[model samples]
Structures are given as structure tokens and as C-alpha cells.
Target: MLNNWVDQLNNTRAAAAPFGEANPKMLTAFRGLNAAQGSNGALDAKTRELIAIAVAVTTRCDGCIASHASAARQAGATEAEVSDALGTAIALNAGAAYVYSLRAMEAFGQMGK
Candidate 1:
């Protein structure tokens, strides 16, 4: 396994506790956002968790990966489904790099003029 995801989730929660305590308002707002998402009902939990996993991969957030992976599992996301989501993330990252490369080339061309 890449990581002890359960332990990582636990550790992340533990580490976040102090920050949450230090800034209760920020924590409340964050929690409110989560609650709003949960109540939205437009997407099911499994789909949301899958999207979260993909975003976590793209953002390189270990904590989010651990949390969302567990949530995905609990929401009945198959391994194949998670893999597909990851593939999408990989493709998006590659696409972003390709777009950025075009911008770099544009800047390089401008520098030459």
C-alpha cells in the first residue's frame, strides 16, 4: 500500500484539531461548506467521494486522498471505479501541462521578438 490510509486520516484529524480550535470561525465555515455540499443532494455520496479522490490526486493532497479514499470505499466505490477516476486525473494533468507548454512557447516566441 502507498500509505496506511486509516492512520493518515486519523493523524490528519488529530493535527487539524488544534487549528480548528485556534480558529473556530474558520472551522465552522469549512464545516458549513461541507454540510452544504452534503445537503445539496444533486450528487450522491459515492460520486462526490469519487470526485474528491480525483481532485485530491490533482491537488496532491495526501490528507484528502486518505479521507476520500475511505469515504469512497464506504460509499461502495469499486477499485476499478477509483482507478478510472485516477485515470481521468492523470489525463487532466497531462492536458494542463500541454496547455502550459503552449503558453511557455508563446512567451519564448515573444522574448525573441
Candidate 2:
């Protein structure tokens, strides 16, 4: 499963690699999102890379997270910024798992009594 996810993520990154000004529609379409539309023309390459990293982490896409984290650093994201972003991801994942597991079990115990 992990390797499958990794291959899928690599394929996705290839799809999103930027081309030239002739056709920026991939970054402007319904697929790219309305709020983030026009980014292909407007945002700096470095900024885009950082956002990609954040998205990877948020999705818990381990392969994508590793790839984009490296890309972000290469594009000038600082160690501090990268570490903070990853730390937030870790905290959120842990919190969600704890609630779903421990809190649910606690609630179940109360109901059974």
C-alpha cells in the first residue's frame, strides 16, 4: 500500500510540472480550484513549491510530502518554516487519531455502564 501510494504521488508530480505561457489552464481550471486560479501566471515558482509541500503534508501523502518538502527547501523555504509546517501536521494527525480511538472508547464505556 505504501509503495502504491508513492508511485501514485510521483505520477501526480509529473502531471503538474510547469510548462510555458502558451497554456496555463491546468493551474486555472476547476481542477486547480477557483481561489487558487491564475496561480500559474501570478505566483512565483518558489511560493508554489512551498504551497505544494503544505498540501502534501495535509493530505498525509507520505511520498508527496517527502518529495515536495525537498522541492520547497531547494526553492528557498527555510528549515524553520518546513519544520513548523510538518510539526503542525503531526499534531493534527495525532489529535484526530486520539479522539477517534480514546475518546470513542471512553464514550462507549459510559454507554455500556
lDDT of each: 0.94, 0.69
lDDT for each residue of candidate 1 in 18-104, tens digit (9 for 90 to 100): 999899999999888977886858989999999999999999999999999999999999999999999999999999999999999
RMSD of 1: 1.1
lDDT of 1 at 56: 99
- Model 2 spans > 4 angstroms off: 1-10, 15-30, 34-55, 110-113
How many clashing residue pairs appear in each of the predictions shown? Answer: 0, 0
lDDT of 2 by residue, 39-70 (tens): 66787656676667676777867766767766
lDDT of 2 at 47: 67
Error of 2 at 82 (Å): 0.3
lDDT of 1 at 93: 99
